[model samples]
Target: MEQDTLDLAHISLRPFQLSDADDVMVWATDERVTKFCSWEPYTSKHAAVDFILNITTKFLWCRAICIGDRAIGSVSVQSYSGDDKARAKAAEIGYILGSKYWGKGIATKVVKQVVEMAFVDLPDLVRLEALVDVENVGSQRVLEKAGFQREGILRKFLFLKGKSRDMVMFSVLSDEIGA
Candidate 1:
C-alpha cells in the first residue's frame, strides 16, 4: 500500500525530502542518537542527503517523523518474508526519534498509528514485529504501550557500531488489535 502523509496531534509522518538533510543531520550526527542504532552516526550533510535520496526514496513504507515542517526522525515497516502468500503475513517495524523529542510519548503515538494502519488499513498483514536493543528501555516501554507482546531475545542479532548486539523481539498480531 502507498504510504501517504499521516497526521497526528503533535507530529506527522511524511515522505522525506532532500531539503530535510539539515534537520535530519541535527539528530543523525549526535552520538547519543546512534548509540543503539544499527547505522553509524552520520558524519556530514552529504551522508544525510544520501540517506534521503537513496534509502528513504527506495522504501515505500518508510517515512520521516516530523513536527511542524522539521524532520526529526524516521519510521518504517519492512516485509520479513518474501512473496509467499500462504505463510503467515508478517512485517517488521523500526523507528528512531531525535533525542530531544524522546520521553514525550511521541514514539508511542507514532507506533500506535502504525499498528492501526498495519492491522486495520492493510488487510494482508497479520503481524507487526519490532526488534529493539536490549539497553533501550524507552523503546521497550513504547512497544509495550502500543500493545506489542515481548516474544524473546535475539542474541547477537544486529551488528551496530562495530560490535554485535542483542535485541529484544516484540510483536502484535492482527487479532490482538481486534482487527
Candidate 2:
C-alpha cells in the first residue's frame, strides 16, 4: 500500500506480551530501524523474548505499537527513579518502528498518543523528552511533528554505536499540552 493511503487510525499502543517475540523480530532484526537506537539489531528470537520478558517490564511506561493487534514496534518512557529529586519530575521517551513501516506517519501518530497518555498515566511527570541522533532526520521530524520543542544539541553527549554522537534534545512540558 502507498504511504499516503496508509490509515494511521489503525495504530495503537499496548503492553508488550511474551507472544510478541516473532513480531518483535520484524523490526528488532532490522539495522535500519536500530541505526539510531542504543542497542544493536537483535540476532535471535531469544533476544526478543528476553526483551519482552525482562526489558519491557523495567520501563516506567512501555508498550507495543500495534496495528489491528499485530506488533510493529514499541514506545517507552523511562523515569529517573530513586531519590534523585531533581530528575524525578522528568522522564525520557523512546520509540522504534519497523523499516517496512517508515514514511507511513505511523510513528508520529503513535508518539502523539503516547505524549497525551503519558502525562495522564504518570502524573508526577512534568516533562517528557527525547534525544535524537543528529543524523537521524526522520526521527527528529517525528518528534517535531508530535509537538516537542527542539532544544540545543548536546555535543558528544552520548557514545553509541562505537562513536560519540551529538544529539538533539527535544521536549514537551506538561503545561505545553492543550495550552
Candidate 3:
C-alpha cells in the first residue's frame, strides 16, 4: 500500500458514539493494533458495542479519533481513584490508531492533542502519564515525540496475554506543557 501524508486539518477527537461501532472494529479487531493494548483483539461486533457503551463511559475523558465523521481510533485520560491522595492529581493517557494509519504521524499528533486537552479539561490534573510495553518501540516514540519524559521502566508491572511484561513509564507535567 502506498502511504500518503495525512493532513492534520482532517484529524479530530470527539466523544464516542454507538454509531462508531463499525469504525471502532476497524482497529479494535486488528491484532497489529491491539498487540500492545491491555485488551485482546475483539472477536465480534458486540464487543465493540460493549466498549463504546460500557468501557469508554468509565474513563475520566475519552474521545474517538476521527477523520471527518468516521471513528478511526480512540484516545483517553483515566484518573486513578480511591483514597490515595497522590494518585488523585495524575491521570494515565492511552491511545490506539488503525493499523493502516500506523507510521503516518497520526498517533503522535493525537497524543499531543490529548495532552493539551487533558490538562485544560481537568484542572486538578498535574501530570499525564503513559505506560508502554517495552517491546512497543512505536508507542514509546509516539509518547516521546509528544514531549513526555522517559521516567524509567517498571519490571513485571502488568500481566497481559498470559505473561508478565516490563513497561516504560513516561510523563508530562501540566507545567511542562508547551515548554
Residues 1-179 of candidate 3 have per-residue lDDT tens digits of 23487787788999999999999999999999999888999999999999999999999989999888988899988998568887999999999999888888889999998898889988989989999999999999999999999999999999999999999999999999977
lDDT of each residue in 1-179, candidate 2, tens digit only: 44556888788889999889999999999988999989999999999999999999899889999988889999999998678888999999999999888888999999999999999988888999999999999999999999999998999999998999999999999999898
lDDT of 1 by residue, 88-107 (tens): 48888889888888877789
Candidate 2 stretches greater than 4 Å from native = 1-4
Deviating ranges (above 4 Å) for candidate 3: 1-3
lDDT of 1: 0.85
lDDT agreement with native, every candidate: 0.85, 0.93, 0.92
**Over the full model, what C-alpha lDDT does candidate 2 score relative to the true structure?**
0.93
Count of backbone clashes for each model? 0, 0, 0
* TM-scores, one per candidate: 0.88, 0.96, 0.96
TM-score of 1: 0.88
Q: Cα-based RMSD of the predictions, in order?
A: 5.4, 1.3, 1.5
Candidate 2 positional error at 114, Å: 0.7
